[model samples]
Target: MRHIKEYDGLRGLMALWVLVGHWAATIYIQFPWPANLGNAYAVDVFVILSGFAIATLVERKRETYGIYITRRVLRIFPVYWFYLAISIALAWVSVDMWTNAAGGEATSNRLQISIAALDNFWPNVISHVVALHGAVPRNMVPNGEYAFLGQAWSISLEWQFYLIAPLVIALGVRAASSFKAGLVLVLGLFVLSYISPRFPYSFIGRYSAFFAIGIATYFLVNVGIPFLTQRRIVIAPIAMLIVTALILLQLPSVLPVSIWIVATASVLVPSQFGLSAIAGLLRWKPVQALGQMSYSVYLSHMAVLVLAMLVLEKAGITSTYLHAALLLIITLAGTLIISIASYNFIEVPFQRLGRNLATRPQAAE
Candidate 1:
C-alpha cells in the first residue's frame, strides 16, 4: 500500500500531544489553551486513525488474512514487547525502592508496592502479556500505575482492533453493495457505544463509533467527498478550528464521544483532499521522521517520564514548575533518542521480516 505522509505527520503530532498530556498530569504543569487538551482526546484520534489506516490498507492491497495479520503483528509487537520488558524491569526496581524507602515507617509507597504485587500484579501482567487488558475490567493495579505501563491500556485496545480488523473489513466489503446493510452496520456500532458505559474496559463498545467514523471517512474519500475536496486553505483552517474548539472546551461530560469522532474526521478527511501547502507542512522531512518513530515514542515516553521523576526526586528537585519542565525536556529528548534506536533496530528488522514472510507464496496461503 502507498504511504500517506500527512497521516504520518498527524501521528507524530498526536504522539507529542500525548507526551505533553502525560507531563501535565504527572507533574501538574498546566499549559495554555491548545496544549492543555486532554490526552484522552488524542487517544481517540489515534483510534480513528488506526481504523482509517487499516481500512485503507485492506482496500488498496487486498492482502490475504494471513499476510494482514502478520503485518500488523510485526508492526506492533516487537516494539511493544521491548517496552513491556523495560516496564517490568522498572516495576521490579520500583518495588525494591519502595520497600527500602519504607524502612519500618508507614508509607504509601510500601502499601502501593504490596498491592501492586500481592493483589493485582500477576493478573495485570497476564492480561497485558496477552494484550487483553483493554477487555478485562479490574485489570489495573490499586495504585493506578497500571502495573507500570499505564498508557498501555490504549495499546491493548489497539491490539483488540488489530485482531478483529480482518473480520471488520470483510463485513464492510460484503456490505458495500447495499447501503441499507452499511447503515445497519453503522447503527450497530453506535448501539455498542451507547451501552459501553455499562461495561468497563469495553474498548470496542466505547470506541467503535470513532472507528466507524474512520471507516466511513475511508469510504467517503474513496468515493470523493466534494466538501472535503475543496481548497486546502478552506479545509485546513476549518479542521484547525475544530481542533481548537475541542481543546478549548475540554469536552464537557455531557457531550458524547461522537462529537470528538466528528472533530477527528474533520481533521483527517480534509487533508486527503489534495496535497496543498498545509499538507506540505505535515509532510516535512522531520515531521515524517517523527511519525515513523511515533509508535516507539508512544510506548516509551511514559516509562521515561516516570524514571526521570524518580531521578529528579532523588536529586531533591522540589519546585513543581522546574520538575515539570525538566521532566518534559528529559522525556521528550530521551524518548526521541530511544525511539530512533528502536525504530532502526527493532521495528525495521521485524517489518522487513514480516514483509518477506508475507510475500512468500506458501506463507500467503
Candidate 2:
C-alpha cells in the first residue's frame, strides 16, 4: 500500500534503457548481442510491475471500481494525448520536408517518411485516439508503423490492462486464501496466452503471463514466501543467470516468456528480503524522480529521436557512430526536459482532478 520508491527507480532505469535501445535500433547500430532483448524484456517488466502496483494499491485503498478506473484514465490519458498531438504535428513536418526535398528531383531516404505518412493517416489517428490500435486485427498505421508514435503499442496494452485491473484485483483477493486457487489463476493466464493470436497483438496473448507474475508476486510477498525471502543472496544470482541465458539463447518459441517471469521475480523477490544495497540503489532520489516522470519520458523519447535524426540528416552528419551518439544525447536531454514539463503541467493536474473526483462523496455511490 505504501509507495515503493524502489519500483520508481526500476522504472526509471527501464525507461532510459528503452530510450537507448530505440536509439541504437533506429540508427542501425548493431550491438554484439541481440538488440531487442533488453528493451523487449523491459516491457515485460513494466507489465508485471503494473499488475503488482495496481493490485497492491487498490487492495490497500479499498478503492471502488469507479474510482480506480477514473484515476487510471486520468493518470494515463492527458500526457498521452499531449504527446499524440505532438506526434501528429511532427508527422506533418516530416511529410512536408520530404515532399520539398523530392520536388527538386533529388533522391533522399527522407521520402520514406512521406510514404509512411500517406499510409492510413485517418485510420491510424482514429485508432490511436480511441486506444484500439494495438487491439485491432490490422495495422493501425501505414506500413505497420504506429504512425509516429511506434512505442505506443505498449501503451495500448497497458490501457487495456487498466480497464481490467479491478477485476484482476477482486479475483486475486478471492484466491488469496488458497495457494492452489492462486496457481489455478496463474495457469489460466498461461492458457489464455497460449490460445491468443500472435497477430493483431492481443494483450492477453502477449502479456498475461507477465501480469500474472506480478499478481503472484504480490501474493507471495503478502503470504511471505520463506524460501524466496530467506535465500535472496543465492536466488538473486541464479535468477539473473537464468534471465541472461534466456536472453542470449533467443529461443524461437515461447521460452522467452519464462525469462520474463523469472526476470520480474529476480528483481522483486530480492528486494522483499530487505536487500539494502539494492533498495538503496533503486531508492536513490534522482532515480526516483526519473521514475516519477517515466511515463512522460517513455512517450516523448521516440518523437525526440525522430526529430534529432532529421536534424542530423539535414546537417549532413553522415558518420554513423557520431550520429548515434549525438542522437542519444539529444534524445535523453530533450526527453527529460519534456517529461518534467508534462509531468508537472499535464499529468499532475489531471491526476489531482481524478483524486478530487474519486474522493467526492457521490463518487462512492
Candidate 3:
C-alpha cells in the first residue's frame, strides 16, 4: 500500500498521449493508423489505472464505504464541474461559428463541438450533472458519449466504477486467496466486456476487462507476489505499446487488451529498477510534476486547443504547417497554465475539503 510515484508518471504519459492524439486531429494530420486510436488507447490506460488506484486506496485506507465514496465524488466532480462551466461558455460564445461550420460541406472540430453543445442542451446538462450522461443509450441521445465535454464520458464511467469498486474489491479479496477463484472473477469480467457494447460506449462494463486487469495487477504486486519485487517489468509495457501500434491496423480490437496490458504492467513494475529507460524516464522530476496535475491536463487540453485554433484562424495564420505549429505552442502553454491554476484552486481545495469532511467525527451514529 505504499504510494506509487510511477503510477502518477504513467498517468502523465497517458494524458499527454491523449492530448497529442487530439492535437493531431485538430491540425488535420492523418497518421497511417486511425487518428483517434491513440486517444482511445490512452483512455483505456486511464481506466486500468483507475482500477489500480481504487484498489490501492481501499486496501491502504480502510475507510468507511460512505467516506470513501464521498472522497471520490469530490475528487472527480469539483474540477470537472469547473471545466464544464468553461466548456459551456466557450460553446455559447462560438455557437455561430460552429453553426456556420456545420452548414459547410466539410466536417471539422468546430462543427462537432457545435452539435454537442446545441443538441438537447438542457437535457445534456441534467444528465451530466448526475454523471449519468455516459449511460444514456445512443438512441436516446445521439452521440451522448461525446457531448459537452467530449472527454468527460470517461469521467462518468470512472464515477460509476468508484461507486462499485468497494463491492468489487471485497469480492476480489476473497478471490485473491485462490487462483481458480481469481481466474473465475477475471473470466466473468471479460464476459461482461464481451457484452458491454450492447450498452453505451461509456458504460463501465465496456471497459470491464481493463479494470479487471488492473485489479489483478494489484493482487499480483501487493498481495500475491511481493517477493517478485526485483523483476524488471517496465519493458513489458513499452513492448506492448510498440507491438500494438504495429498490429492495430489489422487488429483494431486488440487495442483495449493491449492498452490494459501496458497499463497493468506499468503498475506491477517498480519505477526504481536499476535505471531501465522507461522506469527512469517515469521517475524524472518533470514527468512526476506533470503526473501530479494530469487530470487537469486531460480535461483542459481540448478547450485550449479549440481556443488556440480559433485565435489563429482569426489572425489569418492559415498556412497549414505554421498554423499547426502555432496552435501546438499556444495550446500547450495555455493548457499548462490553466491546468496548474485549476489544480491549485479547484482540485487541491476540494480534495482537502473532502479529506476534512470524511475524517470529521460522526455524532451518535
Best candidate according to TM-score = 3
Better of 1 and 3 by lDDT: 3
Q: Pick the candidate with the highest lDDT.
A: 3
lDDT of 1 at 135: 71
Local error of candidate 2 at residue 92 (angstroms) = 4.0
Off by over 4 Å in 1: 28-36, 92-118, 139-145, 178-191, 226-277, 362-365
Q: Name the runs in model 2 displaced over 4 angstroms.
A: 94-117, 139-145, 175-191, 226-275, 362-365
lDDT of 3 at 54: 88
lDDT for each residue of candidate 2 in 226-282, tens digit (9 for 90 to 100): 555575544556556755676698854234355344434435654544555666777
Global local distance difference test of model 2: 0.71
| Model 1 lDDT per residue over 325-357, tens place | 897899989999999999999999999998787
- The C-alpha local distance difference test score for the whole of candidate 3 amounts to 0.75
Please list the Cα RMSD from the true structure of every candidate, rounded to 1 decimal place.
5.7, 5.3, 4.5
Candidate 2 vs candidate 3: which has greater lDDT?
3
Of candidate 3, the 10-residue stretch with the lowest lDDT total is: 98-107
Alpha-carbon lDDT, every model = 0.70, 0.71, 0.75
Q: In angstroms, give how far residue 306 of model 2 lies from its true place.
A: 1.2
